[model samples]
Every structure is written in structure tokens, then in C-alpha cells.
Target: MREISLDRLRTLVVIADLGSFAQAARQLNLAPPTISLHVAELEARVGAPLLTRTRGQVRATAVGQTLLERARRLLADAEQALEEVRGQVAGLTGRVRLGASTGAIAHLLPSALATLQRDHPGIDVQVQVLTSQASLAALRDGRLDVGLVALPQTASKGVKLMPWRRDPILAYVPADWQPPARLTPTWLAARALILNDSGTQLSRVTAEWFAAAGLYPQARIELNYNDAIKSLVAAGYGATLLPQEGEGPELDRRIVCRALRPGLWRSLGIACREGDGDRATGHVLAALKHLRQ
Candidate 1:
């Protein structure tokens, strides 16, 4: 059996993520040839081409994807082993950059981070609020140690997405606008709405749902920030859709939040680079799961 070097495995993971040796090399700070040599060495040992390259983009072969999964587990276990040893001697200390959407940032992340901090005081954590796609992209590019994103990401090629939780997508109406007994397409179309920006998954889903129901809302304004939407709705500017749990005190007092009648909900969860088989990701995931439970 050929011994697998962690360095080679890391190289393969990086290439699988960035889809180009040059990009991976730049990320790893290695010469492109050096990175290529590492991948070639692994391919030689595995006896299969790990990457299928055409033009400038690269993708993992079936065998490569399978190996990538195992490699991620192996790498994570390896890092955990090292962390365990280090902790036994001194302590675990490192920074982890995590990304989340506005909804998660408002509802889920603070408690999760507080719990993690209680357990691992030495570890520093930073959180970035972004759209689900942006969060997934950051995770793949190795910028984030982990992220919480809505499901059905367009570029989830090398990611391990798991269900985090489901939250209701509520319709927010201004105080003056008399809302219907039920929020239906016909009823909602009569009112002006402040829709989420086109970039977010929420915006796409909302548009799809409305389109499917043959409802075109009266246009008022467009905004990316959910908080802004809530604020505008409160001030009687327009109605909007937001997560059920995302109702702030001020918004909750002023607006009526009700579940969308046609059963629209967002499935969200934690994700990380498959290569991040590290103690940090595992511990954080476990903590998150515990919180959800």
C-alpha cells in the first residue's frame, strides 16, 4: 500500500476546490509545478486520474470525488489527533472565520458562538454576514473555516451540506395596510412590497414562489438587508418577506408576521470546505447540532 502524504491530500483538496492548479498553488503559496507534482504523485499512488481538466476549469472525477470525501475525513481526523496531542501538552488556540446569512446572524449564531466560547475560550471566532451563495463561495475558497447557508447552493460541488434547520418565511405587512385573513398570491399582489435584493437565495425563492402563483407584487422598493426591509415595512413604506424567527422587537411590535400560506420555508445549515476535517469544524458542528436539538 502506498502511504498517502497529508501534503498531497491537501493539494488535491485545494485543486478540487479552486478548479485550477494555478489558483490552488497561489493559495498554498507553492510553485505550480510543485503543486502539480504533488497531485501527480497522488494520482500515481491511487492509479487513477483524480482531476479531469478542460480549458481552464477542472473537476473531480467520480473516483476523485469519492477519494475527496475520504480524504476530508482523514484530514479532519489527522488534525483532531494533532489538536488532541497539543491540548494535552498546552491548550488549543486558533482563530476560525465563520460565515452566516442575515437570518442566522440575527437568530441562531449568537447563542451558538456564546456556547462555543464558553467551551473554548482560547479560540477566537469571527463571523461574516453574507448571502448563502457568497457564504458557500467563501467556504470553498478557504476563506471561511465554516458557514451556515440555505440549501440548494448552485456551486456546492466540493461541499458537505447538511440540514441545519427550517424556518418559516413570514410575510411582513405595514400597520396601515389591511392584511388578508390568509396571505395568498391574489391578496399579496395588490400591495406594494420591499423585496430582497436579487443577489440572495431568499430573493430568488421569493420571486419563484410569486411567479409560480402568478402574482406580481406592486413595486415599492428593493433592498438587500433584511433589517432594512423590516424597518421599511414598519414605517408603512411596503411589505416584505422575512424569516419567522427574524422578527426584531421593534418590527415585531409594529408588523404582523404570518407564515406564507403556500408553505414556503428555508432549509439552512452549516458547511465547510471538505478539506476542513479539523477539530474546529467538528466541534462547531457538534455544538450547532446540540443547539438545534
Candidate 2:
């Protein structure tokens, strides 16, 4: 029996994603005929058709879908194995793409990334600031190598969540607005609020926190980015609940962060697609853990 080749599996995965042999060929930088041969060989090895080809579109069959999943995992593993052989003796030299919330990018990640760069000057890190949902999607699609996300109650399909640190969630109020010594649900509800946008874990948690207090806030303004939310609060637009790290010089001067009476907190964590647990991934995780301490 002929062994299945990584080359064929890659072709299968690319065709599955790109939805056309020509598109797959273009993506892989291979001739269309070569891609056809690779898919044919893969079908023969598996003893079933992996794809349904029509006029211009390619669709994966049940078996094809299964193989595509395994093929992506296999390809990611093979790439990681290549890096393992290269090792840290290779001095962590590779592009590491990371996704993080804007707040994390502004305060939480800079120091950690600085430590990583200082220790491994060869590693080129690309950080994308996005909403938590966007970050999860990018990580699953293999564009982002890892993510720094606030722990969501429910995990996404292909990622593993690991707690990295906890940040106090404080209420940021305009300096001119003085509140009672202790913040009550009624008092909080009376104030207008700014919130993180829909579809974000932060926004969901914020809703949960308010609901738990039996308080529905007055008119709420939604913003997609935490940095923007802070800016709005700093400009005295409205108070917002934000992670403590959101209190920077700009915010401190114009706003005051009051720690919640019962101490509301958010958990920030390191996350990666489940199968990306290679030595380099582990090393990066270590770097995050080191920073957390």
C-alpha cells in the first residue's frame, strides 16, 4: 500500500479551504495539473472520493471534511516539528503572530513582549489588537499563533484556554462625578454607561455583572475597542467598567477608577489552537507564565 503523502494532504486542505482546484493551485503556487494529480493520489490512498467537483466549485464530502480536519492538524504539527528540530538553539527565530484585546495591547502585553524580545531577539512578533471574538476566529483560522484573551465562560471550538493573570475590573467615572463611599447596584444603575461592543466576552461579562446586581443602566454607548471606551470616559462622556490596566496617565488625570466593592475581576489568559502545542509554543507559554508571576 502506498503511504499517504503530506504533499497530497496539503493539497486536500488547500482545496477544501479555497473551494477550487485553480484557487488551491494559485495559493500553493503549483500548477493546476499537479494539484489534480495530488488530489487523485490522496483519493486513491483513502479509497474514496475526498471532494465533489462541479463546474467551478469544489466541496468536501464527509470523508473529505474529516480528512481536511486531520490534514490541517497534521500540517500544523509537521511545521512545528520542523521548528522543534531547529530548536531554541535556533534562538526562537520565526514569525509569531499574536492577537490581544486593545486593553491588553496597551498595558498588559507590552512588558511581556518586551521580555520575550529581550530574551529571544531572533523571534519576530506580530501583535494584532482585536475584539476577543475576532481574536478567537483568527486563531482558529491559523492566522494567529496565539491569543491573550479574557477567559470566556464558554471556550471556542479549536482553542485551549489557560489562565495567565487576573485584573481588577473597576468603574471608571469622570473626575467631576463624585459617588457615594460604597457603590450600590442602585447607584450604578442610575448612571449612564459606556460598554464594550456586542459579541465580546468583556461586554457579555459586563452585562452579567450588572444583571447580577439587579440593575439596568441608563442609556448605554457601545464601543468596539477598550482603548476607545477609556478615551470616551476620559473625555467625561460616561462612566464605564474597565480592567484596572485601563487606568493610565490620560485616564488618571480626567477620570478615577474606583475598585468595585465586592472586587469584580476579569481573568486574562493565554490561548492557542489545540494542536499547536509544540516546544516553541510551550516556550512562549512559559514566557507568559513568567510575566504573570
Candidate 3:
């Protein structure tokens, strides 16, 4: 048997609802003969009479009633599927996968995400904690929609990088240790340091800062998580240098943050696939740009 046409199903449904062939034809904006042909085709496909005329009123047979229920569900599902696609095309709803470092996710992303939520509630942003290199790699591999990366990165193929923010790298020390007003490379070098692991771009940036002063100091312990490093600093484990994101949280009472004498800074950039055209990612990228310092 051939397929049952949605138009024919609709005609039968309308005729049954209105109880008049003339009314169904008018409602469907189709001629009376077309309506009759639609019913004839539908009944031929079903191999049974689908409608009955009694007392000059139209009604459906039992088989037609069953088909009407299934047809209504199919029509509703088709309409819903189209609406969801339309929402995505309009940039009103979608899922965006974003990658960033723990520091960026903690201090820089909260306000931006809150703003995004307020402005585009239908957009869902999924954040993954990753190093700058890992984020860039994921962007290249099509595993990430967007990335917040450390700057001065060597250009990668198929990745576009845009300068986003530059934050001052400050010295975080134990409160009991009376540090100088401005911490110099020499002063910080004398103290035991809790540094970022060698794998991170932050570690490279910190190394360059010390190398500029002809001082290469060793760390007491190396770690990647900024919050954990801060916890150790509060416990008087060691002093560390890290960027203070704009208007970040208050420091622990046991720890003190001080300016660097030579004013070291950490630069960050936004990374995404070159020539990418995703609406949800575009919305997330815009929200992240608002955090630029």
C-alpha cells in the first residue's frame, strides 16, 4: 500500500470535527471537490469506509476515530520538532561547551555566567576545567565550543585567538611574614614558594618573570589548582605569585596579597575554531568578552 498523506488525514479530522463537508472545506481553504477527493483517497488507503453522513451531518467510523487520535499525535510531534529547530536557528536555545582554567572558572566566569543567564535563560553553558594548552587542543579537536586560554600562545592551526584580559600577578604570602610594601623578585625568591606545575602556561609566565631578574628560584611544591595553592598559603606553607582576577574574593585572614615591584602580569585570550559559526557559542563568547579588563 502507498503512504497515507497528512493532508488527507487532516481533511478527515476537520470534516469529523465540523460535522459538515462545506465547513471543513472552508476551514481548510480547499474546494469541496478537493475535500471529497482527500476523503476518497484516505478511505482507499485504509481499505474501509472512513466517514458516514446521517441526518445531513458528517461523522467518523470507528477506524477513522482511531486514525484521528494517532494522526493528532503525529502532527503535534512534527510541530514541536520544527519549533525546537527554529529556536536554535534564532539563537534563543542551545547547549554551549566551554573550557577554562579553575581560576578563570572561579573568579572570572561567575558574573559573566550570571549575566548570560539573565539575558539568555534558554542557553545552557557547560564549563570544563582545563589548562590553556588542553583547552586549545580541545578546540582544535572539535571537543570544545570555546576556550579561555593564557595569552602569548604560539598560534595553532584551525584556532583563532583573541586577547581578552590582562591581570596583574600579585604575591600571596602568609600574614605572619611581614613582607615588604612591594615584593621584588629577590624578596619572593628568598621565601619558600608554592608554584604552578611546569606543564601550565602560568608556570612559564612565572618563570619568565624571575628569569628577567636573573633569579631562578625553586618551588617547595608545585600544583595546578589556584584555590589549593591559596589554602596552602593561608596555612603558612609558602608564598606564591598568581594573578588577582578583577575584584576577586577577599583574601584569607591568614594570608596577605601584595603588589609586585616589577609589576608582572598574566594575559588571557579567547580561543575558538577558525571560521566557526555556532549561535550558542557566539552568545557565550559575547558574555565572556564583557569580563575583559
Candidate 4:
């Protein structure tokens, strides 16, 4: 019986990433022959060829692809575990990977992360802007430690859901249009609509808001960014539905923000792996809760 080496696994990963054994050798600060020996060792242990060299390039073999995937997770887990142990010895210090929606990143996290950093100076926070659907997938896959997503999101048995805050949905029209103080569904639907991604939670709720009034607003444009949508609407291209929070204080000069007639709101919540023992995650989660108060 033979044991696989972590160093070999790491070199394999680096080779796959850099696309050449020579490049990987440089990155690992090892000689090319050493790199070849490492890969040869792994192939011998697994009874398979791990890579194939093409014209001036190197690519992973089928077995290599599978091993690479597992190796990455293993490496990440190993690194994270070491960080946790180190954190316990020193002041709290580890990386917390946070997945958040655009709105949450824009409006919510700046203050929360500021507080987290201030309270736990040693902890490093990394945030990625993701849609609710994407955030949920990442959370389940262990890529993200915590996700800030819309409520009523798909619940998986492996995660814990915590309600965060509700952001009101608002209507944006051309600044000079003189919109009514309170916008109506019928009136909103009649205008040319610029909405969020068709697959997003915001879009689904916007659809419901329209269906409730028995009107289907034809979108003049569909986009993922509020800033882009605002600029387009402000240019008198169309109207849009955007969450009230995270919107910049001064909108594009041409757009005016108004409250929706029925006062619609979308709830945001945090999702983390069930029974996660990471102290850094706990600290950031607590910071979010405190900021919300």
C-alpha cells in the first residue's frame, strides 16, 4: 500500500492551473525534474496517467480532472483548518469568504465589514457579489462560508437560514416625468420597464407585483446592474424597479425614485453551513446582526 503526498497533490494542482510542467515548476520553486517525479509518483499510486502533453502545452487527463477537483477541495480544507488552529493560538485570525447580493454588498456590508474588521483586526473578510441562486449553490458546495440572499430562497437541509432585513422595492422614472408621489401597478406596468435579470428573485417578485394587478409590463430592457438600469431610465429610455436600499444617494440626474403603490419589499437573509464551527464566520455573522440592530 502507498500513501499519496500532499506536496504531489499541490504540484498537480499547480500544473493543471499553469498548463505546463515547466511553468508549474517555476511557481513551486522546484526543478522541472522534481515536478515530473511528483506527477509520476501520483500516477503510479492511482495506476493512471494524470496529464497529457499537447503541442507546447500540458492538459490534465480524464483521471486528472477528477483528481484535480477533489484535490482543490482538499487543499482548501487543509489550509482553512490550519488557519483555524492558528487563530485559536493567536487572536482570532482567519479568512471568511462571504457571498452577497449586489444590494447587500452595496448597502449592507460596508458597515458590517467595517465593524468586523474593527472588532477582530486579525480576521480577513472576502466578499463576492452573487445572485441569490448562485449564492445558495456556492454555500452548499463549501465555496462560501456565508451567503446573504433573498428570503424564501431554496432551503437545503445542510444549511441554516437567518433572516436579515427587508429592502423596499421602488420605482424609478425619468426625472422630468413628474411621476405621482405614490406609484400604482397599472401606471407602472404601462411604462416601458427596465427590470433586473429575468432569473433573479427581484424579477420574480416584480412579476408577482404585476400579476397581482393583472398587468404584464413589457420590459424595454433587462439587466443585472441597478446603476446601468438607472442610467438608462434617467436617459428617458424607460422605467425600472429597483430595491430602495443600496441605491446611491444621488441617482443619475435624469431619474427620479418613487415608492411603489402597494409598498412591495424583498427580504434578505444569511445562509451558512449547518453547525459551522468557524470562529471567523461566527464573528462576521455577529457583526452583521449588530449592525442591523
The CA lDDT of each predicted structure is 0.78, 0.78, 0.91, 0.86
What TM-score would you give candidate 2 relative to the actual structure? 0.65
lDDT of 2 by residue, 93-133 (tens): 66678888777787767676778778877666788877666
lDDT of 3 by residue, 28-119 (tens): 99999999999999888889998999999998889989988998888788789888778877888888888999999999999999989998
* Predicted structure with the largest lDDT when compared to the true one: 3
Per-model C-alpha RMSD: 18.1, 14.8, 2.9, 13.2
| TM-score (C-alpha, index-matched) for candidate 3 | 0.85
lDDT of 3 at 237: 99
Clashes of each: 1, 1, 0, 0
lDDT of 2: 0.78
Q: Model 1 lDDT vs. the true structure?
A: 0.78
Candidate 2 wrong stretches, greater than 4 Å:
1-91, 246-250, 276-279
TM-score (C-alpha, index-matched) for candidate 1: 0.65
User: What alpha-carbon RMSD in Å does predicted model 1 have with respect to the real structure?
Assistant: 18.1
Worst 10 residues of 4 by lDDT: 244-253
Model 4: CA > 4 A from native: 1-84, 88-91
User: Largest TM-score belongs to which candidate?
Assistant: 3
